[model samples]
Target: MTDYAFSSVNQLANDFKDAIKNADDDQKKVLKKAQAKFSLIERNYQIITNLYNNNMVDEQRPLYFFPSSQRLVAGKEEKGNAKLIVPFEFVGKKLYYGLTATGTHDLNPMPFNPRYPMVGLHANALNTILDNKLIHEVSKAWVVLIIIILGVVLAFGIPSLSPVQGGATIGGLLIGYTYLCFWLFSSQHIWLDLFGPAITMAVGYLGITIYNYIQEEKNKQFLKESFGTYVSPELIDQMYESGEEPSLGGEEGYHTAFFTDIQSFSAFSEKLSATDLVSLLNEYLTDMTDVLLDNKGTLDKYIGDAIVAFYGAPIEIENHELWACKTAIIMQDNLELLRQKWQSEGDRWPEIVHHMQNRIGINTGQMVTGNMGSASRMNYTMMGDTVNLAARLEASAKQYGIYIQIADTTYQPVKDQIVIRDLDFVRVMGKTEPAQVYELISETGQEPELYKKILPAFHEALALYRNQEWNNAIEAFKASDELEDMFPGRKTNPSRIYIPRCEHYRDNSPGDDWDGAWTLTSK
Candidate 1:
């Protein structure tokens, strides 16, 4: 019976071998076709990489194939029992598969066993499982969708919530989810999508946080750019640290306004080439702006050769008028030094021989001050009659031949620190009320006695004029003008034009209710 069984098994084994041969032939044909297709695909990938000058790793190339072989082995004890084993290798990696079969004819593909004393079969099964897992994990759209959702939720939700609350929630969720997934995957051999969702969420949160931090820095940069030009660096630093932003509209405030312009800048500019002209102007503006900023003033704007600036707005300053007056004196002193330097440079210097003479006017009043302009653009500035009056005072400096003049209101506060002469009390070209103009003659150290002598007499003359004593007032002014001439190198020469105007006003008596104020007809 056993012999008969052996014969039967042998016949079955032979038939099964024939079947395997036939299957092998069919598989060979299929492999040849697959190889051709894979070769074409690999060539195409190489062509693309070459065109782009890309040096990609060989493993990264997508075209790949697996070559496998199977065999049947008969067992010694049982007639019909035999073993089937399949082996596979790819890219230098080995794979193996093995299973028990009743006969070669009944042999079939089977699940792998790692400890079945068949290394090739074990390796083949492992490779198959790994490949299937990779493909399945990558191809599933639901996994990708979940990753995207998690990324979105992390990015948008984290920053919006309080830091404490958001961080705790995210930390707990990540820990619990990761633990659960790992437990399931390691113990039950179940694969879960881990890398995509976790990586996406982490990157999204980090990206959003970094982006917000960058935006905050940009805002700080913008603030520095906008206001740094006007205010002091210390003040700007304070503003930035305080986290308060400047408004784009004007606010009413009590401020000390200062205006300055180069005397006869037009004729001087016309003499130089455009490049030299710009350079010269820039030098003067830069020097003056430095002085203004040092004194904590807000530079409003530059009107041609003029600089209009103010103090005690955007930020409050206690002694704004004093600072403004000090700035003017410093500017005048600095100009003298600059002029000497230019003169020493000799003929190479431009023919326009400018002496760095400046006319400065200051006034203290309630004015509108802020950044004002269209939605797209704006500038820190001041507006109102006080600003206009300050400008008019600068213009009037040419008539008085003075370096600096201040409205009576502006001078009233800082009169002790400065030596000033009451130059005039007349209605400016655009105003009905009389504004007393004072010449800022000197500071404490320089020309104190001369300023003292000149200012008293000048004030007496102004008092005479205001009291309607014409003849005596004219005599006082003539005396004052003479005294100014005696000090030959005085910063500003007294205007002869004013002598005539004062004489005319004295000769013709203004109306009875006249407050001894002269009217101006032109700007």
Candidate 2:
């Protein structure tokens, strides 16, 4: 019976060898045959052990076909079709090994065919065995650690930097990490993964950069829409550079207030069609407004035929009063050019349109300047007594037959830079305190030849009128008017307007306490 049992076991082993040789490259078939043969050997372990112990050559030979057996003398129980050994590729060859666990490492070959143990296996399989869960867990932990560190850095750091700086920082991190991984691998033979951490940082950088780009564009659009029509491009650029929004609340500051209106605009409105009126008004406004913006003035709003603007708010100008004075003269000069252009158009415009005139008033004082109105609707504008006086001056220019009127405050700071004439010392309709008003004639050295001829007699006439010498004042006024008439095509001189005033005062004299300050009853 023992002989028969030995024959059965030997026959089974021979059949397993035959199956492995016949299976060739079929690893699953070889594994199936090995399982069957190993199962029988497990059942008959005492018989095989006794044969091998008795020094029989065939039985004593090592069964290298069996996988490593630190758990048992033979195959481990693979219940539910779970494999105890696994197949892996090595050096372009297929081989099998016992599955790796926490503390087990066996690199010795496990042959598919017992006749040739080295045929289907490689010596490099030892390195493959070492590439196990332990190494993978360490690599994965390293990757996670790298990702966490870089994520924290990029989240906090990238936003503070500009686009170019952020990009360069990302580049430096990637290059530095790549070099670290390569150095570890080359110098220490550590297999730290490059692809995982590299991809994570790259994705993080791209996401942050895109988000910053979108937010920057949003801020830029907001600035453009908010201040585009009110402030100059240069001020808008300054706001963008500062990365701050203008305050919506009112602020009190020293500013120069400006107001302008077309002279006899009501007559033009009566004469022209609505479309032609709008066209003409738009052309005039565009030309005048360009000078204001060019000199860094903030436009407040238009009131029919009037333009209201200011300087030294939202952004401060170095010499805002001076700038306002310069802009007024430039606008008048531009109006003259437009008049010439309209005249050459050959009566497409009316004769009155060709002779279009406007009045400008400027004052410098403390005022409230900011976005004003309800929450849902607002206008960036100016208010206070200064602004009111500026409007009053604009309305009162018609009385003096003048084109440009400026308060004494506006004239004092820029008096050396511009040519101006003292028009009057008067209290406008709304105010209690009287202000000295002046006519802004031209920039220094740019006054007309006619001003040179009439100004001497005009100055004498003004002094006599202030002295209350009505008779001499009337004669001096007429002389100045005659001098103005010498220059043909001149507008009605201020001298001519004062003549009747002198006549009236001569007839009904002001009291002895009269301070030579006229009180205007109308705006």
Candidate 3:
């Protein structure tokens, strides 16, 4: 049995041959007769263990061939079959066998693979025994402890960080925890199940990240639809992320209102086809609206050729009245440029194109502004006396033959910032109180030298006309008439407007309490 315990089957066969060579001629003759049977049975038994990939029975020794236990003491080739054991390539010392494990999945064999499937597990078991590194598996209570510790800490920590910071935090925690598990396994032969806690943190943070992404997209879409046409996209995005989301309700605050209308727009539309009308209006509105939005005005709604807008609501603005007045001034400048461009088109447009004009009005006062309407639909707009006053003033601009008009309140704060001339004190329809209206002369206070020379005489004429000095007022107004050419694109002049009024008042004057304010009879 001892002589047969060799590494390879060929080595054992050589030992068997040596034993037969030492036999006498008579014993060799008997051995040679039974050699074929012995070789077949031994090879068949060895092949059985490798076929199943496991050891089911201990190998038997050839004791019956020796005939007695006392004869087994002698060194002979006495074995039923030599047991095969898998070991390391260089290991020649101790070997492990019959390793036991519970509830393990079967080693699934793959085709075309030359190595046995169970070889890895066998090597691991053998290594554990050799290195004294068998794992002491963690208990149910230990796994639960890990879950509670990590879950409670991460729950409070993740939401306080931004998405990138939160992701980094979660990644760091998982890597650190895995390191701890590996450390315990190497140092103390302890194995911990990281799957439960790893899954908990992953699901928690991933859910939060997904929810935040959805909310951010919602905010961006809301801002784009609500304010894209009225302001810069960057401003809208910053306003949304500022954490003060605007809703339906409003706060009480002083604000400025603005209104504008194109003169004879309906008559212009009658001369053009629908497609041509839309193209012309699109270019005209885009130019005027760019000026309005550039000055930071919130566009309300368009009524035909008219636009209604306001400032200083939803978010407070500094000097909003001046912003409103400046936008009105810019509207006229852009309107003039468009008129020149259209005039150059000549026969490409209708005869009405030569007379393109716009009138604007601005007023400043306290008003309610918000998203106002039914529950199903609402519009962000202003309502109250200030809004109506601005609209009335714009409508009344045509009566005074001026392009831009603003209430006294709008002019007060912006007095030094803009060029303006007093138009008249007029009692607008539907109101008992009369407002002092001014014509917004220019965006910048800079004026032509010709205008500066004519304005002094006009102011003198206006003072005399108000005081009922008809003859002197007529002479002063006539002296200013030569400067009318400086105010281009108009068939009428200020002196021409007031000379008839002064004549009518002079002939019919007997009233004692007239305040000299014009009472407008129509819009």
| TM-score, every prediction | 0.57, 0.69, 0.65
Tens-digit lDDT string for candidate 1 (67-144)? 523333424324322322112113356434344444434244446532333445556568768766432233458777
User: Which is the leading candidate under lDDT?
Assistant: 2
- Give one digit per residue, the lDDT tens place, for model 2 in 1-523: 1132444756866655665666647775655756575765554565456555665536333333547643323344454232232111022564454444434443333445323334224435555576642222235776788888888888998888888898898999899989988787666657788888788789999998888779878887787788789788888887788765657778888999999999888989888889999999999999888888889899999999899999998776789999999999999899999999999999688878988889999999999988899999999999899999999998898888888999998999988989887789899998889899998999899999988877777998999999999999999999888876432223576889899889999999997888778889998
Ranking by TM-score: 2, 3, 1
Computed on alpha carbons, the lDDT of every model, listed in order, comes to 0.72, 0.80, 0.76
Model 1: how far residue 361 lies from native, Å: 1.4
Model 1 pairs whose backbones collide: 95-123, 95-124, 96-120, 96-121, 96-123, 96-124, 97-121
Alpha-carbon RMSD to native, per candidate:
20.1, 15.4, 13.4
Say which prediction, candidate 1 or candidate 2, comes out ahead on TM-score. 2
lDDT of 3 by residue, 1-523 (tens): 2344557767767766776798888877666544544675575565565544555335433332234543222222344233232222113564333323343453444464433345466777778888887789999898999899877767787878987898899999999988988898889889898788889888878887887789789878887888777655645765776765556765456999999988768887789899888888888888888887788788888887788888875566789988888787678778878878888998888767766888888999988887788888888778899889999999888776677889999989988888777778789988889999887877555665766877787888889888889888888888877665534435566667778777888898837687878788889
Worst 10 residues of 3 by lDDT: 81-90
Alpha-carbon shift of residue 449 in model 1 (angstroms):
4.2
Question: What does the lDDT read for residue 145 in candidate 3?
Answer: 92
Q: How many backbone clashes does candidate 1 have?
A: 7
lDDT over C-alpha atoms for residue 395 of model 2: 85
- Work out how many backbone clashes candidate 3 has: 1
